[model samples]
Target: MLPQELDGVTLLVDVPLAGLQAGDVGTIVAITRADDGRLRYTIEIERPEGGTADGQLIDLDASQFGLD
Candidate 1:
């Protein structure tokens, strides 16, 4: 079983983004659970200073990001 409420948890992204390389940080916005227990995470990417990145909200696999 996994914690269903993870909206505020920070995410350490390891995927590429708009004008940014992998390893960009993001925040978890939503999550969906598959019947098989795999998680698809909705992440909101942001610029280093502030504001939303062009990448914005995207779905990521569990292997693609880390919890912060």
Candidate 2:
């Protein structure tokens, strides 16, 4: 199923993500239907080591992620 807003998910594909892996967990911050009618998600990836909330936000297609 597609992830909803504020849902926790994991990356299923390798991206340009730093300090994170393909299976790294992230939170869905926002969702938007693209011009092609595909649902895109804005995810925030926190440091795996743990520290602050400082992390990178990335936009990915629903197929690139899996529900956590």
Candidate 3:
């Protein structure tokens, strides 16, 4: 399992949240388990060029991301 605040890259297209594409670098803000007891992540991706002002925080399952 990944640790909190670890940096990583997205591995899936999270269309609902700012259209996060594959390879977008992000940081794991928090780690929590889903209703099914599966691990989930709250990732904060600082918008490139736009910086944190246009960044996004999204929740995703473990399979949707990887260590950077």
Q: TM-scores across all candidates?
A: 0.58, 0.79, 0.71
Best-matching candidate per TM-score: 2
Evaluated at residue 37, the lDDT of candidate 3 is: 92
Cα lDDT of model 2 by residue, 1-68, tens digit? 65788898888988853544588778999998889998889999865687543467888998888988
lDDT of 3 at 8: 61
Q: What is the lDDT of residue 56 in candidate 1?
A: 81
In candidate 1 the C-alpha lDDT for residue 6 amounts to 54
**C-alpha RMSD values across all candidates:** 3.8, 2.6, 2.7
Residue 38, candidate 3: how far off, in angstroms?
0.3
Task: For candidate 3, write residues 1-68 as lDDT tens digits.
Answer: 45566666655655545666776767888888889998888888756777543457888876777776
Q: By lDDT, highest first, what's the ranking?
A: 2, 3, 1
Clashing pairs in 3: none
Query: Worst 10-residue stretch by lDDT in candidate 2?
Result: 46-55
Q: Candidate 1, after superposition: displacement of residue 60 in Å?
A: 0.3
In the range 1-41, model 1's lDDT, one tens digit per residue, is 34233543344444445444466676777889777788877
